[model samples]
Target: MQTAQRNSLRLLQWMMVASLALPLGLFVFASAVSWVSIRETADREIEHSLDVAHEHALKVFETIDRSLSEMAEIIRDVPDADIVAREQMLHLRLKRLVTSLPQVKSAWIFDAKGHALVNSLVVPAPEIDFSDRDYFKAHVDADIGTYIGEALTPRPPYQGAPFFGVSRRRPSEDGSFAGVLQASVFPEYFESYYARIGREPGSYFALGRADGTVLARFPIIDRDIRLDRNGPIAKLVAANPMAGLITVTSPTDGIERRLGYRRLAEYPIYVGAGLETSAIRARWLSTMSQHLIFGAPATALLFALLGLALRRTRHLHFEAERRQQAEEALKHGQRLEALGRLTGGVAHDFNNLLTVIRASVDLLRRPDLAEARRLRYIDAISDTVTRAAKLTGQLLAFARRQALKPEVFDVSRSVQMLSEMISTLVGPRIEIVILGSEEPCFVNADASQFETAIINIAVNARDAMEGRGRLTMAVGMAASLPNAAPLPQHPYGYVAVSVADTGSGIPPDQLERIFEPFFTTKQAGHGTGLGLSQVFGFAKQSGGEVAVASEVGKGSIFTLYLPRTAGSGRSRQPATDAAAIDGSGTSVLVVEDNAEVGRFTTDALAELGYAAKLVGNATHALEELATGAERFDAVFTDVVMPGMSGIELAQEIRRLHPELPVVLTSGYSHVLSEHGSHGFELLQKPYSIEQLSRVLHRIARRDVGQEAASASS
Candidate 1:
């Protein structure tokens, strides 16, 4: 009896001890968790605050920018608005804006001499001289654009004080400088907007220039203060061009905060948001506290009960192993997908290089080379380079990074051309059929990529057939697909090109994954698995779709639906005046920023028997034209250069001298729209000596004929 009583008492004592210890441990854990939770919550709140402020600041900035741009555009179009009339109209516009927006502090105009013509402030100051200001000069001399000044000013006489200004040059139709159109708005206008943006009480908000000139701040509420680029916030500004959250220690508070920055390119400003670290930690802490608080005691009881009621179930371990394997497989698939995209981009650039080399070599293989063994050797050198270029192009096309020269071409013609190559490619084992629409279906696709895709499919089909099969090409329209959007159509229409193969069909399970990058069922050495992926990428990039249908016992069909058009019939025409080239006495002005390129161009022009004068940039070119008044027959310039683009220079020149002919050259031709105003001709870059000579001759002849006709009239 004594022994049993002693054991029972010991057990009871142990239970009491555990009960006391549990709460003490819970207290420590809960407190730690709560601290973390509170900190995280605070951090999140701060971030939210900052984000809201940044967004609000951006909204205000955009509104101001848009309003000013509209105002400038309106002023430019107002025909009746001479100096006096313009002052009156501007006052009316300013009053309306101030009343509607409630943020615009003032709007004013500066005469050519920088004296205020009109002020929109409530108690407007008398005209002040701003001629000495660099911004004033910048606006006056801008030539083609508005000049935006950094945020700084004395508080305005208007209800809303302290303003930044944007000034644009106003010119008369007769080519005389009219005056400067200036729009000024209060910094508080932005700060107020920033303050009201959703954010935690302690969140920081700032708006600044790309160079870190602080324009507005919410908490600090400072105007005309610039942030040091070497500071923490400035570092965040420098790094966060695309805008995402980052963690940084606050220089002001010495506490870590998550920072987010958004660049407002339209306004050329930066919006920054900062959230406290404590805020993010708060949520984590709260959940963790709740989990531990209730879970500990419940878990202890459950453990005790589970131990008593435990029963083993078979196959649990096997199921777990299978799940782990599947997870690993999924991870590997994702990695492959990323790698495929990277490889595709690399391949695209390689193709363009190959195209250039191929063209160069083809041009070099002249009978004139037969006169000397030296000439033959040079031709061979060109051929070798061309072959290597072709290989690089093949790789880049597979990778999908090559810049595409897309055009509407017949799908049937593409198939027919591929058929000619298929006999040798498939070793006479595969029979190729070209089934095309009688109506001539067309698609906006790069012809080179299209050919590559067909070849890859043929290779795959050959492999599936084990070196023997029938490949049927069927061209038609795809009735709407489940997930596919309607293909974009030009004046003509759209069609679907289907390549079907009779061979060992793909397994049902692998069918869905067949188009996935680097996925293959072929023997290890037979394929790279990028063939189908390349086809899919090319189709997608070309604004088309690819579809697949297959059965294990039957065959497989891949449909490439593409937009079509009636043949443009405007076939690629070779230069007609190539044989009759004469650039004698043709005065040409060449505007290029690169010193080496400019020198090479002038030297090349001189060699081609033309007079060439090279200027450093568009600004210098414009200045030269204005001051020298040199009557050049043509102005040849690079489209993309520092200061002013070739397009802008062309526009300015046409305004000044309408009779001058322009030929713009660039590596990138997509920006031709910017040159549309002057109807200038475009020449793609990396031109050879012959191409330059031919273009110059053509321009010179055209100009001479026009001048001659005008003189006779």
Candidate 2:
């Protein structure tokens, strides 16, 4: 009995020790798990913050670039002080760029000699030399790109606050480096948004240059962070990867931080967002405190169950996160692949066109080149540029982002005009036949985009036909058709432009997906598969829709339904301008900034039997006209120039000489976008010789008729 009792006591003591140990083990395990969870959450949060910071930086950088680009282009136009001093519109625009964006400190134009010629904030001050500035040095050597520089100490009387600058190089009319257009942004601008960006108390954020110089940092603890010469950030940025993570000790403070950083694709700037590991540990401790209050023995069972549950939950959470990451990566891969394919196809076409242009240009350089061959080479380059433009314009329309300058135009006439080009696109084997309505089929939409859709459809049909079949293009008003697609409200009527092909048709299952972007039935390198999608987007964007009827064996018919406006008999397309009127002996004033463009305009006009006098800018043009030395029938000017935009110049001409027709031309003009054509004729840039001649002839003839009619009355 004594032996049995002694053995039982010993066993009981051992059991007691194990009971206490179970709860202790559970607590330790819980603490470890909570720490891991907190760390994971912190990592995710900082990563998201990093992306936001990156986007913010990119947006700011882009705005800077865009502003500088416009400024640089304008700076090339004006050569004298009177033009810059007397220009209110230019001053207002520059001031607006600075004042509109809260982050922008100043916008200024610096001459090649690094003298501040014009400023957004103040009147152009004399002798403000920035020759020693880092931003200036970057642009002094390179003619392309906007450069982000290290922080700059405030220039005298400006205060002690430091600022960083972003600058773009401006080239002269002859393509020689002229100056730099720059903007300064204060670090405090970013600091103001730190609360929002780094929401967590112990979180950190920073903006750095590509040279690994950290410009701004949150916690305001570290203002100057000149990174190690060849550290991880330097190496990572040099590699040019978009995003990555790094753990480094803060140079400003001794604290260790886990940071996520992202780089801007176009700019040499990076944004980093991070949190201290101590932050995570603090949160983990807080969480453990809540479950640590229970009695050790009672908590033993609860801890056992909780541990299993927590482990399982974490496993599932990890799996969910992994799956999500995998899906995102796959999506990113697909997008990159599509972009690669698209770029590859575009590059091939551009290369072919450029090759022709290069060869023609080279041939032209020869002193003894024949006149006939010279003209042919010039025409070839022009034609190739047009082809390249059409290709890119189609892509832009498909993106649905190109600004639409809607005009009332006849669809039938446009189709008629495009027939010759369609033939060229479809090749000699394919026969293109146009079927038009006797009545006018008019739509209010962008005419070039409308024609592009037609071209894309015809090209698609030609491919379906294997380049040898009949392609019929038909256009008519909805009421005239026996059966047409329903019209969208708002437009008075609708017009159907049908492109039918006698070729192998699409499969029933593939028809629905054919309009999806990058979904090509053709083999690789053959098609971008954007044709149908372009047609669809154009129609929809024009307040219209696209429909199709297909059969496996029979050829398919694709119809584009566009919103129509009030109209009557089929109108003649203005391809040769007014075929009856020619610009013979008509003196035109050509006001252009770029020397090459001015030369081309003069040569093209001279070639077409018109008298052309070229001047550098509006001031010179005005002075020439003011002298009354020679009579000018019309004025053709570029819309966006330094001292005054073409629209403003045209206004001045109209005020001084209303009878003299003023023609405006632009590739893209903010003046045109804001104020519109304003009753003057507009010729889009990259215009052909024929287009220029036709426009000039039309305006001159119109002006002559008006004068004649007035005199007779």
In terms of lDDT, the best-performing candidate is 2
TM-score of 2: 0.44
Tens digit of per-residue lDDT, candidate 2, span 11-79: 889878877786778888988888888888888898888878878888888887888878866766676
Model 1 TM-score (2 dp): 0.42
CA lDDT for candidate 1: 0.68
Q: What is the lDDT of residue 685 in candidate 1?
A: 57
Taking all chains together, each candidate's TM-score versus the true structure is: 0.42, 0.44
| Count of backbone clashes, every candidate in sequence | 27, 0
lDDT of 1 by residue, 526-551 (tens): 66566888787677666667788888
Q: Which window of ten consecutive residues has the lowest lDDT sum in model 2?
A: 479-488
lDDT of 1 at 302: 80
